[model samples]
Target chain A: MSSFAPPVQRLITELGRLPGIGGRTAQRLAFHLLRASEEDALALAEAIKEVKARIGLCEVCFNLSDGPRCRICSDERRDAGLVCVVEEPSDIIPIERTHEFHGRYHVLGGALSPIDGIDPEDLRIAELYTRVTPPADAPQDEHPTPIREVVLATNPTTTGEATALHIAAHLREQAPQVTVTRLASGLPVGADLEYADELTLGRALSGRRALS
Target chain B: MSSFAPPVQRLITELGRLPGIGGRTAQRLAFHLLRASEEDALALAEAIKEVKARIGLCEVCFNLSDGPRCRICSDERRDAGLVCVVEEPSDIIPIERTHEFHGRYHVLGGALSPIDGIDPEDLRIAELYTRVTPPADAPQDEHPTPIREVVLATNPTTTGEATALHIAAHLREQAPQVTVTRLASGLPVGADLEYADELTLGRALSGRRALS
Candidate 1:
């Protein structure tokens, strides 16, 4: 049997499952939690429980929410006609941090990865299509807003690019009026974005040759 | 108001409070938990609760335990006469992994730091003395095991060295029969044991001069 008690071992194991956290890091984190005040430790537990119990996906945008719709989708100030599509809910944060996008967002849950068995159908592609093209027999009291622009703000990775292309092709056939665009590919403001290959960088550089 | 819902934001804040987790990492972890299966997420929560509820400290060694005494102290095989002193309970794991020491441990909670207001009284120094020299009135049926060797296994930091020296001096005056030995100062098996400073390297070099 392991030297550590069952409960302590379990905590360590659970912590190690997190991204970037190794076994040693997990042990350190567990010990830190143990040394912390009961109130502080329990607060973290309560926070995890509360988030799981209360927060869910926004019905319209698939962003994290406490109710049927996320705060972004419910806000009257955000432009409904200009939708920025992203791969994951976490992707939206950096965009928001930039304060460059005033439009609404469509979270795809994840990008298309054929190797990982993720496809167009696996994403929120159908939902996005519906948003761009509403039914003709919609309620008279609530007029549906026609999406003018669908910025494919997915990650610059191969999967992200493939997802954007797949959705763009579908939108063109499904709704001809909507304009689709991808985030500019170039050296990031700071460093790398997703794990976009070096060849993609060459293309990005070629595209940006005249700008500099 | 923040863009994220209250519960989501609260979880991110709580996650950020952990030792190496920054705001971005916390947000990622919080979202990963949100995306994880309810079973997986709740298991982590349950583990945290269980550890706090069940685990306490080893009465003799101060290591983490489920009952009055830790497993090491209760074990019949481990020698009580030879105790390895460490700064924290977490430090015991590495020594155990090495399989070099079969003795019991005494966790001092932390190394002495006068600048941080930590003194001899702040640590379990007096308790170490008591363990080394038991009461004469102890029953013959319950014979106290006299500690022969005290290994100063504290980290090789400035504070750790100072703490070791302080304990060694006290042991010299109080229990001259007991031998107090600090861990050998040398190059680590692998580089980078939490940024070993220049002075520690210098000490290691001086100690290794004859052999090299």
Candidate 2:
């Protein structure tokens, strides 16, 4: 029989289910919670419950939100005409941190992976197309600023690349007026050339610019 | 302002309070929980709440328990006369895993650290004394078997060493009939002599047993 009580064992099992958490780490976390004050322990439980109860996908872009729309989508200052498409809601954080993109975002939910059974239909691709190209019967006054540009900010992986190309091709056929662009893939900033991979080096050479 | 919604941010903050969980890890965990099914997320929250509500300190040894006494304390098969003293209840796990100890345990909560202001009074030292040496008026018939041996199994750190010596001196004066011993400190099994520290090497030589 296990040394710990049933409740402790249950807590350990639950914690072990989290991403990257091993059995030893789960035990350590359980003991920490046990040592923590009742208020502190309850606060963690309340936070988990609250996040699940309140947070939902944004109606417009499918990013995580507490209400019908995400904070970025609700903000009047952000440019709705320009949208950055990413694989997941978490990807938006890094782009926002840079302060370079003043436009809004559309979360694809996940990238396309045929081997894993994830396809364009499985993601929010259809929803994205609807946002980019509204029906002709819709009032133009309501959407005064038409979608001008779409920047594909998906990851540099094979599936991410495939998804971006697929979306770009679809947008070209459906909404020819909108410009579709992919994030530049080249050598990472401040990286040593000796350690740079062949693929990244090849891209850097092709995308090289003349410094005037 | 943070990119995440208020509830998402709150969950991240709460998860960050756990030991070894940094800001990035907390954010990852929060996002994972957000993506998880309601049943899975709520199960974790419920488990945390249940552990806190149901588990408490064992009345006898101060180990974590769901009832008045710990499992080891309640087990009639365990040796009542032989007690293994440890700094924390967590320490008992490894010893139990070894299957070398059939005796009950006494959890001291923590070792004496003068620098950290942790003294004997702060721990369960008084309770241990009571268990070892009952009052003179206590009926002999009620206690069928008197405590015969105490194994000090605290860590080999400076504070642990000091606490063990302090307890050993006290027990010697209080109960001359009881045999007080300490866990041996030497080179660990399967450890290389060349890699061993000077102090540990010296202890191994001094405490070396005669070959059979």
**TM-score of model 2 (CA atoms):** 0.97
CAPRI quality level assigned to candidate 2 from its DockQ score: high
**Which residue pairs in candidate 1 collide?**
none
Candidate 2, residues B60-89: lDDT per residue as tens digits?
Answer: 789899999998888889998999999988
Expressed as tens digits, the lDDT of each residue in A105-184 for candidate 2 is: 99999999999999989999998898898878878765666789999999989999999999999999999999999999
DockQ score of candidate 1? 0.73
The segments of candidate 2 whose C-alpha lies over 4 angstroms from its true place after superposition are A139-144, B138-144
lDDT value, candidate 2, whole model: 0.92
Candidate 1: which docking quality band?
medium
**How closely does chain A match the true chain A in each prediction, as TM-score?**
0.90, 0.96
Candidate 1 clash total? Answer: 0
> Interface-residue RMSD per candidate?
0.9, 0.7
